[model samples]
Target: MRDDAPHTSNVPYLPRRSVHLDFHTSPLITPIAQQFDPQEFADRFARLGVDSVTLFAKCHHGQLYYDTDRAERHPGLGGVDLLRSQIDALRPLGIRTPIYISVLFDEHAATTHPEWVCVDEEGGPVRVDSHGVPGWHVLDMTSGYRSYLAEQVTDVLGHFPDADGFFYDICFDQLSSSATARAAAIEAGFDPDSPAGRLDAAAAVSHDYMGRLRDMVAGDGHDGVPRSVFFNSRPRLRLADELGFSTHDEIEALPTGGWGYAYAPSVARSVIPIQPRAIGMTGRFFGSWGDSASIHPAAALQYESLQMVSLGLGICIGDSLPPAGRSHEAVTARLADTFARVQAVQECATGAQRVAEVAVMRAPITGGEGVIHADAPGAGELAALRLLTSRGIDFDFIGPGDDLAGYRAVIVLSGVGIDDGVVRSLTLHVESGGALVLSGLPDDVASLQPLTGLSSADVDGFAREFVRPNAAATGLPDFDFVLPGAVRRVRAEGDVHTLATVTEPYFDRTPDRFSGHEYTPAGAATAYPAIVARERVATAAFGLFEAYGATGVPEIGDLAAATLEAVFPRPALRIDGAAHLEGTLGRRSGSSIVHLLSYLPSRRSSADIETVVDPVPALDVAVRVRLDDRSPRAVRTLEGVELPFSVEDGYVHFTVSFDDGHCLVVVEEE
Candidate 1:
């Protein structure tokens, strides 16, 4: 589990990544108006740069996506051999094929082997879906579902030896097995009087079931590769690691809203590195009334996915398959284009140059937008975290009076905004080889002046606006490149842009609401930072790119890349994210690539659409493009492009021009 060597595990999510898609036809899928052509669909995937596709299946339909050593056929739909053509067609495209098997629901298995069905205390069978509606039915993880699943997957994999891999969707073992059994036991008086006792017992049972399933599939590497397990929304991804499983999935919101986008940044930050080599990451942007990351370039998708990759996480892009049929031409074309860009990210990034050893663990709270407020970041962000587990970064949501020591960095996201102590802790951390990146209203910077040996006599903090980090000004490198354009200027020393102002919204301002506070941002800080970091380094350190990134030239010149490369050429962990889509970027052993989800632009299309998003987007993001920098250039985004930029004092100010109601600007050091 050390960074010096490869961490051995059963799950592997790299090179040939898998995705989930819908089915056109299935033997037991009842009757429907839409029928998708397997060949056409397979060919379509090949064109879209997809390596694998899956079916949201319940029964082992006779169309035979999986071979049956068991029962027989259902005329017309029997032995269609859909996997064969897909395997054959995908080969030339360099795509590996993988199939997804729904573990919990199988109308066939339920009917054929009724005993396998979990029975309630009332002696009734568990029901997951009643009248075709999605609902939870706690199943028995300790039962025959293990062998049945193994047999089903094994049979499917055996049928198509050419299949690239298998992605297990709806991990029934975790929730169905653990949570249900615990809830049921509590109700049945299995220590129901004690909540802690009930939870402990349930977890023990859940852990046992998952461990068994993992042991059954411990990487013989047959049928392309073993099954890739996605433990849905569970923070304890280590459960998968302990079970010899690798890979995890999460739904994140678009940045501008930032690392706090939907989910807590610390939550994603906490688990990303534990097993990043083949770690799985995913998210839903949600609430994109209409906007793209680029000029109709699936902006949201590109933004979120890229950020994840830079953070050293693999991506499993997710989206709902059309309710009617196979993908529409527009959907397919955009996907192809989006994935191609991801490939480019993989190409441009290499070595440890973009991957930094996560010396700190910082995860702020989620929900409630605006300046510092206690309840803004949720309780989920406050869990205890083990940063040392991930070879790189480690983060946990900060709680009231939480002791933060023994870390080189302490990251605070959009949780409670710029708290005086949080600022002091980061300053102390930086003073001791630590670094910090506080995304969103970073008014706490003013609090650091006292610790950094600076006078904060004229500091006036606001949220919104922007400011840039400086290696020379602050003697910090990690934060050098993350500059804010229109900061609130919370503090001021003569003409210098000190800590910026960020107002805590009335919604985010419930000091006493910490207990009953359903975090709601009701006020606003003067200016909020989209991205912020606290950096430290000696002035003798040359070729420092962070401070020089805004200069549009390598700080140490080309020599930085050649002479004393390790020293001059600083290595970093690039947490890449774009708006629109969700995914991850990670490096294990030296090979680094950006795995991504295809960005879904607004269903409505228009030209030159632009909008202003209050909070800066979260997740790590890097935009690759050629900017016409005759002035401070507003770099182009999937939402749209801007041609002008501004430079004033030590700040770089600019507005993003996009038709989709979003704007972004960077204020890197010059």
Candidate 2:
């Protein structure tokens, strides 16, 4: 294990409110810096409560915004140093301005030196089209473009000596199918076309480039003034050890933009622990980044900002500067409204450590393939997160190799196959009195049988089945028929108790045996166990979470919650609120903060966009926090309103009227 100490930044400050300004300009949009008034821009940012902003030093078109001696300035902007002017204006206002430099897609560099462009196996330049715009050719870092990029970065640093950090964009893996890349791979003893080989080669090249960049930036810092470095992609992977913060441009254009509302939260939750400082970048475009005139609703921005803070992540709202260089007042006002709310909650959330009782373990794929089992872990994990957060379960999304000792329970999502090391760790955790919940058919079930007390013979069927609770299943009703997606039959033995049994349908819905629309009618329950439970471990054969995530089935979540309650027995915090209300718990300096966020979107049915409406009044919501030996001294909202509460059964209970889209409850302990 390598020490991660050097990767941590010594920078003393982190801004909760920040903006990522996009300035990817084209020749058609000339006079790039004409409308950009430094004072007006600084004033707008100050009014919006922005403490940090990333100004573009070089755009994807490979045009320099500043008066760079090494690189050509944009032909549209002859002599205006837009980057220098913005930094000069904002720095005096106590704002940290980072320089944004496009690393991969540099059109000017690719055009000027065609040999430096990334080429495919056919010896042709690789180009990518984005958002109906003709894609620019990406530069190959292994070529002389690497030296040019370094010189450009060094020039920017020299010009802006007081700059805050560097934001490297489009620095992910660029798979080269080019003959040159193939020859290089062959020299390095790897197949150019193999997925693993290509991935490894790309990783090596990226590592070298990022390492050189970090060294150059670090070497430039003097007198305890550290310059932060962050890459756009792979924030949690290869470059995490070298970067200052983990960042993902989660431009979640909900309802339409391909990314549903659940994607950003899942990514935020998973990446927060990987880096000491994690920031989520979301754009304000109505559709996405390129929509210049489109403005995201204020309410939606508010919800997104609050969600990021609650997940222990800094929020960076994305906005593209208009070609005229003038900041949009309407967008600034909308962002101001959201930033004010973010500023209020961040006072308590800042420096707070997340308190999670459950850690969801993401398993590796089977067959030694270094790939995720599904596309983005699928909806099963997302639905599980939705259900758990709605129920006020304090949980964290953890990946492989993350420490599991801190959590009281662990959930292995459906379809994830565990390796031997993970199996051993999980078995040890179970033996040490930790709760374990296994969903779906894990590939390494044979190794987990001792902990689960159930051995799988084979998958019996793949039809629609219902799960009816047995008479012995306490806290769960027998009438609940959960439609678990794919049924896997397991043989219960050695103190393993069957909590529920699978009720098979009349017949499989074949071409000839079809009943009505979807599947055949349900029949009586069978002897096979749908859910099996032991002392510290509970295993389910059905892909219940997958079904629930795909269909939003309440029965599946209900069964899962009940089973978890039975197994874990006591969770850290419990909240009685609407399903749309989500809660996150954290502690800082002897006090606990509970962040309650509302998910009531305005346009729920619109597939084009999601907008947040007025906040729903959640009255008389009871929140119970289990305090082992500490006594509650005071309970109040973030706005300092005292809330009435009581203590019983070693837990503090409080009822709050959450009227806003976000509410924070601070519990002072004695």
Which candidate tops TM-score?
2
Model 2 lDDT-worst window of ten: 366-375
**Model 2: lDDT to the true structure:** 0.74
Error of 1 at 505 (Å): 18
Q: Deviation in angstroms for 284 in model 2? A: 2.2
Model 2 TM-score relative to the real fold: 0.90
Error of 2 at 125 (Å): 3.6
What's the lDDT for all of these models?
0.38, 0.74
Clashes of each: 117, 4
